[model samples]
Target: MHIGKPHEATTRICQASAETVEVRGRDLCRDLMGRLSFTEYFCLLLTGREPTDNQRCFLDLLLIAIAEHGMMPTVQAARMTLAADPDSLQGALAAGLLGCGPVLVGTSERCGKLLVEAQSRLAAGDDAKVVALQMLQDIRKTGGKLPGFGHPVHRPTDPRAERILELADARGVSGPHIAMARNFRAAAAEVWGKPLVMNVSMPIAAVLLDLDFPVATIKAVPLLARTGGLLAHLAEEQQNPIGFTMAAHAEAAVTYKNTDEGGG
Candidate 1:
């Protein structure tokens, strides 16, 4: 049984032989291994082409920027999963990665799409500010949340986002996407009647788009980066387990009642 069309199937990503492996048209062991850093290798693998200096720099910078953030929910989930089953490290990591959604590592993908749509409207000759404001209005009309414009902890502006933008401008890579994100920041403040946090996800998407990264896999950035972070958390969990403690805290913080009576 097949779920989708199964026809002429092919893959240009990789192939292997008796003694050699090919990746993106390069010899894996010869041209790739030991020569390219993981960041460079990742870029090549993703785009099937070598990244320029700027692309490479930003990719590395972004990975470092988002790889770890204290004990985020994703980290907590992984740690908890590990505490429950100490032997299955992979399972614990999967538990964390599976939680990537609108509020987590997946936010960058939404932000990327948002920037791309704004760019499209700007391509139609509309003013950038007007395009941004109209898109903000549309999102508000649908009661949708803006993806990259707020954070629970990072107030006023996300330092990571600001750093990425500053680096993009210094490197001369801040293109229309970055501009659109900033425009949206301004429009959002006006539309929402107050300033909102311009979080890291906005600059992440903007820089990747400006660097011509693939839109469909923009989430891969955060997914891969957070995987590194989660692995670190899992390692620490083994030494000083706090997952169960976190679970206990969570249980104590919330009040529960039977649904037939009342719930909170």
Candidate 2:
């Protein structure tokens, strides 16, 4: 059976032969191994091109910014999974990464989409502030959330978001996307009654887009960054053995309601 065009397996990322391995058209052993830092290597591997200095610097920055945040739910899930099955380290990592839904480390992707949409509208001569206000109103009208805003824990503002924007300006990389993000900040304060804390996700998305990183691959950065965090947290869980304690706390935090207990 055949459907549409015939499929062929291929990847531009890497190919290995008996003697040498190639990645993004560079020799892994000769060209990339000693010459590139891990962050630069990551950029090359991801985009198939070496990054500019600003790109490499901020790629490293964003990775550090999103890497660890106390015992976030993702880390807790990893720790708890490890506590339940001490031998399955891989499963624990998978469990943690699985928790990176849109509400978690995956939030930057939504923010990326938001920025892209706003940028397209801006390029079409729509005023960024007006677009932000209209979009905020539409989302509010539909009872939907605007991504890159709000946090369950961080208050007043997200300091990491501020720092990222500051660095972007310092590095001369802040562009229209960053401007639009700021416009959202102003529009949010006016439309939402109070200022929603613009979290780190927005800056990460804005800076990367401004630097010309592929819009589609914006999520990969956070996912990769959080994986490093998860590994460290999982190791800590192994040493301190708090996974079960966290589970116990979770159980104690909520009462078990049995509406049908002996009702039959």
Candidate 3:
């Protein structure tokens, strides 16, 4: 079945000439007088609220941090969707976003919520480090990895996390959320018995919480920013004469043994 046939058409937006500098029905553009940062555009689109200088800076840092990772699932999907000759750029982007679903690009917001939970446990007179440790242990008991701490591609420290933290501290972002990050870091260190820095999501989570965005909004904000790259890849892929084709492939398959089987 052609699952993504409609996505290509969805990305096509009407362009206006210099003589006709206005486009109607795109409310998000109303706030952009000119030369707005990606953060500003993202905030405008997601919240319909222009941010203060501080909020803008914070959001900008986050968006810049996760802006693109070449050949990631999202980008690959965008290229592949275009290869399929979808109807529009929007359709390619939609297909890309579908690939990003929960397994790939959906953890930033969950990490934000986890930071809040870690803080609440601290405020209730529990040691933040201990609380974080216990939480990690609980997740392990349930067969889950601790979120927001490690990444396959970014080891030791997520460079984006490092960059955003630098910006966040320079802007004087302080309070329990910051404290929670610090405490969580210590706990992760103890658990790993070595230094384990926060990944991109953690710093963004801290910054968003500091800016008073509900933790639930963290993932939404990043996803919104990501659509830009998604669209760009889609458009670029369209130039290929062959249209969208699988850019790469793997030939290996895994062997599995059933645990619930009787000798037959």
Candidate 4:
């Protein structure tokens, strides 16, 4: 039985033969192993080109900013997975990474898409504010939550979002996407009749887009960053071992009330 087209079996990402390993057209060991920072190598691998200084700096900053957030579900999942299978680091990492979804680390991609759409409208000669307002209205009408606009803990504003915008302004990378994000913030307030906190996801998306990073790969930023965080958690879990404690706490916190009082 044959699978995909014969051409589909190949990968453009990397190639390894006995004598050499090539990645994105560069000899990985000779050209990149010692010289490029992991962050730079990540950019090279994703983009098939080296990042500009600004891109490297912003990417590093965004990664650090989003990397750790104290006991998020992903971390908990990783820690618990490690506790259950102390021998498998890869399994623990996979357990955490698997949790990256629309409600978590994946929001960056959605927010990037949102900004990209808004930019398209602006390029088509739509007023920025009008586009933002219409977007909020359309989202609300469709009963969809506005991506990157609110957070459970950060009220009124998200400090991470503010800091990202500040750095982008200082570095001169605050381009149209960033401006549109701000416009959308104001428009969201007007449309909702209440201020919505622009979360880190929005700034992350805006900054990456401003840096010309592809929307399709925006989620990779958070995933990569959070992997670092998960590793950290796993390291601590190895030494301190809180995964079972967390599981026990969770079990204790939920009261399994029987809906059918006497039926059981």
lDDT of 4 by residue, 189-219 (tens): 9988999999999999999999999999799
**Candidate 1 per-residue C-alpha lDDT over 1-264 given as tens digits, one digit per residue, 9 for 90 to 100:** 988988988998999999999999999999999989898889888888888999999998999899999988989999999999999999999999999888887999999999999888878899999999999999999999999988889887789999999999999999989989999999999999999999999899999999999788689899999999999999999999999999999999998778888554
Candidate 2 lDDT, tens digit per residue, 228-253? 99999988888999999999999999
User: Candidate 2 has which clashing residue pairs, if any?
Assistant: none
Better of 2 and 4 by lDDT: 4
All candidates' TM-scores?
0.96, 0.95, 0.75, 0.95
Lowest-sum lDDT 10-residue window in model 2: 255-264
Segments of candidate 4 deviating more than 4 angstroms = 1-9, 262-264
lDDT of 3 at 83: 72
lDDT of 2: 0.92
What ranking of all candidate models by TM-score puts the best one first?
Answer: 1, 2, 4, 3
- The 10-residue segment with the lowest total lDDT in model 1: 255-264
Q: Residue 67 lDDT in model 2?
A: 93
lDDT of each: 0.92, 0.92, 0.70, 0.93
How does model 1 score by TM-score?
0.96
